[model samples]
Target: MLLDALLFQLGYNAALVMIGAGLLGLAAGMAGTFLFLRKRALVSDAISHATLPGIAVAFIVMEAFGGDGRSLAGLLIGAICASALGLAAVTYLGNRTRLSEDAAIGAVLSVFFGFGIVLLTVIQAFGYGRQSGLEGFLLGSTAGMLRSDATLIAVSAALTCAIVLLMRRPLTVAAFDPGFARVSGQRPDWAEAVLMAVVLAVTVVGLKVVGLILIVALLIIPPVAARFWSDQSTHVLWISSIIGGLAGYFGAALSAIAPDLPTGPIIVLCAFGLFLVSFLFAPERGVLASVLRHFRFRRDVHMRQGLLALAQGHPIFEDLTLKLLIRAGFASADGVPTDTGRARAAKALRDEARWREVRGDPAFERAAARYDGLTDLSDVLTEDQLREVDARIGPPVGAA
Candidate 1:
């Protein structure tokens, strides 16, 4: 009875955590799709680090404004301010300097983080009675969040979701073909700026559950995994959101059960694990699919080489001699290609009998060549390509 009651209560708490994480995950996934498409994935990481300065400034501002020792509103405003500054810096560096986009991101990330660290040290030295709680923002701990914090996250998530849905068509056009979008009067520049703002907002909300240091993992891993499962943008968005939200809820629950475990690391691990699975086995993009494709191509190359070899000599009237076909791995010593080894090789192509059947045709006579490891389409060819190939064979003997 006691265990049952405990299970019941755990389920209830899990539901609450899931609700908040679900909202946050949906926003992160939608915004992250565009980020990945735009090749601006690292921008999220830069903004997350930049928030440190904002948190420090928020604390300083809260003390000046005189209300509570800590102020969520101040933190939000300060973080947004710092994020805007970082964005401007990245833009300036990319436009005015020779730095690449990633380089600009790295530079801004390091400089702003260094400044935040200095501010942090100063706060500690002054020995303020109030705890800064800034460290929690670094790696995240859901235990530090309350009902009010959840409410803020929920509201931010709703705004992000609304904006993304409304801007879907323009964003898709810009991502797939920016030049075309611009020519069509889509105004991709303003769309890009608005998209970045949504990313920033989502990052801010994530800070409470996953922290600034690890939040980018949430934004990146889910979409990466989702891409392996679906090519369509809409399916990718929904699947990624589901995957991300599940990871967050499980990470939080695990931390709740084992008080020593950190929420941020656990959540990141969950998302990364899913990415690995997707990369290895997600249908079309999986490791298995690529290997199969390579095997099929190699087999086709070998068969085409064999056909060219026979054509160079003369067209055979009937089936290939057992010796010749066996040597080609299409038959056995008994003039039959039924051995398991031969079957395996044939399967790698199409079928063993099928190749022999094609070999008997007079037309197949010209298909074979000297087997010098290239297709020998000497007789059957396109006029334009044939002229190019014949020219490459070099000038007629006396013409040289």
Candidate 2:
């Protein structure tokens, strides 16, 4: 019964965290997709760090206006203001100074963060009530979160995600080819601004959990992971959102249960783990799977080469046999290459040829050249198919 209760409680908390973190993740992932595609990922990072000064300045302004209460509203207002300023500064430096974009982001980030730090130090020195509480922004704490914070995060995420969905076509076009988007009169700049707003909002909302230091991980890892699974931009966005959301909630729950566990690192670790898994095991792009496929393909190719050599009367000793072809399944248990195995290999090569016909790739070249202009590789290919493959391969040596 005790174990059941513990498990039950874990499930309950995990569910709640999942709902909130999932929203956060969706927001980050959706917005991050565009940022990654547009190559503005660094700018997002600079904005996240730059929001610190905005939060500090908002606090200062609130105090001056007799609003000493460190309310969420005050923080939001400050964060927005600071983030806008940072964006402006980055844009200005990029336009005017000799500094490159990365250098500009670094400069704006350092300067704004330094200013915020100075203000925070002053607030601490004065021993302002709950002034130390703002430090949570720098190193996020689930302990400080209220239900309202989650609501804010959810609402912001929803709005941002909705905007992304609505503008998917134009935004995708712009990401792939901004010049073309402009020629098509799509207002790529405006599309980019809208996307940047989503990114900024996600950063602000996620600050309650992942903090500024590691929020960029949420914006980067999930989309990158999703890329391994698909070539379509829409699928990439959806998959990235799911992966990012799972990471966020897991991070939040871990931080809640283990007081020592830092939320930022935990969230980052979860996203990174997903990325690593995708890198190693994703069906089409996984390193291990691709390498295995490549090995099998090479083995089959070498086996076919050996068989073609045999058909052309190339001398072969029993002991000097084709071991590589045997290992690749092109030879039988009797240490002799079987017609059935050769046929199967030919079929595989034909399928690859079809893939090339549709996609036009390197696989097509290899597939066409596999039989040295002899076999069409298809099981029941007609004379037309043979002619097509032969036509694709070009004449054999001295057959001009």
Candidate 3:
């Protein structure tokens, strides 16, 4: 059953819902990347929560006017208007007053969400006409959706993705380096406005699919997950979009497997699963990679120290260092240097001497700055320089 849904073997309505959800996911991922980069992701939360009042008010107004209050278009328009107002308030408070943007987001998020909840309560209490489906907007419901609603969602989501792609360059520049963007003739203010506008559109379009309550996760999780896969900005953008799309498509299908399953939370859970995989296994930045790098570094440190101790005729007391030396064929099991060990020890001793000379010499200051104790002297200097350093230390006292 899961496989069939994923393959779109379900009916036409199910296919349409899947397409709409996937597109919404792509737009959210792209738009979310900019917000994450800008450190203003809370703006999406404020706008989403703010749309609730508009939805409730639109329903009441439509019912009073003797029109179908369940119209998707009317509800969305109201959501847009209300969200715009909320965004403006946040901008005003953040810029015109001492409160920071984050603080403004927090205030707007709490107040508007509370007011929206109150409005929802009023509607239920009064039993407004045809108010059966309004609660669907809270957590998203695509089950038994009209064809027009699905089409509208698909088109809106596509347009949102197109707009985000068109403006990605400037948005990225503004996010990473506003000063550089200014120098390049891109107004930081305009870039900020564009980002907000994009996020607003995503929130509005996503209301019926991912819902206002969980939409911010769609915007945030993909980009964060993609970060684990690559350091390049461009790579992250495409990777995040792909992850978001997969989550949406799979989540929608999985929801169809059971009568009680919802599309929104399922999508979020799918995204989190992807994030978990990236966090644990990504070759560049994952937890496993970090652990392996640490172990390799520790081994290298032990090997270097073991060789140095052998060169100086010092007692090797560290068990790990002795193990490393023996494993590398540098020392006998009894801890005495083998012929190969003696050669490596002499080289390590001379390298240390060369480093000391270079560090103290004014002429070698720049080269010395790159020095680490583990680096061989031959790697850092020419034969002439090595000879000069070796001459100062005289011949090796214990040469074979």
Candidate 4:
């Protein structure tokens, strides 16, 4: 069943759903990157919740006017308007009041969402036509959706992605450095408004598929997971889009296989799965790589400490340190130094003495900072510098 759905054999509606959702994810991921960089992720949440009132209000107004209350275009427009109002309120409070942006966001999100709920209740009480589906916008519903609606979502998503691409440079500049962006002929406020507009578009479009509640996850999870794969913003942005697209395609397919499950949550779960994989196994930043680096560091530290202990003729008591010495052929099982062990120990002792002298002289402060007890002095200082430091130590004890 899963294979059939994944292969697009589940039927036309399933295929349409998958394609539309894939486009949505791709756009959301890219837009979400700007939102993430903007450090205003909470703003997306506020906008999404704020949109709900617009949807409900649009429905009520349309019903009163004898128009189709469930019109996608009307609902989305209402959502956009409400989102804009919410953004304005957030901006006003942030700029004028002592309250922080987060606090303003929290207030707007609660009020707008609560008002939406009240409107929904009033619609139900008034016994509106086919008003049952209105609640689906809270969590999303693809079942029994009209072909026209799916097409609209797909087209909107594609257009949103195109718009975002065209404005990428300015959005990025504004997100990271508003002051620099202003100097570069970009109005920081307008660039930021553009970013909010993109996010608002994504949220409004997503309401029919992922719903207002889960839409924020679609906007955030992909970029966060992509960040683990690369340090560069460009790489992260592309990777995030790919990840979002894959999640949407597979999540829609998976949801199709089990009609009882909702597509929004399934898509979110798919994104989280990607995040978990990246966290545990990404090349440079994963838990497995961190563990490997830690083990390697420990080995080096043990070997260095064991060698020095042998040089000072101190008893090797630590089990790991003694085992390391024996494994490296630096000491016998009895903890006595081999000839090679003696040579290494001598070098370790001489390096320690050099570090001691370097630490005492303020002139070598920068060079001395390189001493981590595991590093070789030769690695930190040039030959001439090493020769100068060594001259201070003189010849060996049996010197002629």
Clashes per candidate, residues 3 or more apart or on different chains: 7, 0, 0, 0
Better of 1 and 3 by lDDT: 3
Model 4, stretches more than 4 Å misplaced? 350-372, 375-400
lDDT of 1 at 394: 43
Candidate 2, lDDT over the whole model: 0.74
Q: Who wins the lDDT comparison?
A: 3
| lDDT string, candidate 4, 33-90, tens digits | 8888888877889999999889989988888899999888898899999989998999
Report how far residue 209 has shifted in candidate 3, in Å: 0.8
- Give stretches of model 2 more than 4 Å off: 1-18, 315-321, 325-382, 385-400
lDDT of 1 at 389: 41
Q: Which pairs of residues collide in candidate 2?
A: none
Each prediction's TM-score versus the true structure: 0.75, 0.81, 0.93, 0.89
Q: How high is the lDDT of residue 112 in model 1? A: 94
Q: How many times do residue backbones clash in model 2?
A: 0
Using TM-score as the measure, what is the rank order of every candidate, best first?
A: 3, 4, 2, 1
lDDT of 1 by residue, 18-82 (tens): 45666777788788888887888899989988988988888887876785536676787888899
Best by TM-score: 3
Comparing 1 and 4 on TM-score, the stronger one: 4
Q: List the residue pairs that clash in candidate 4.
A: none
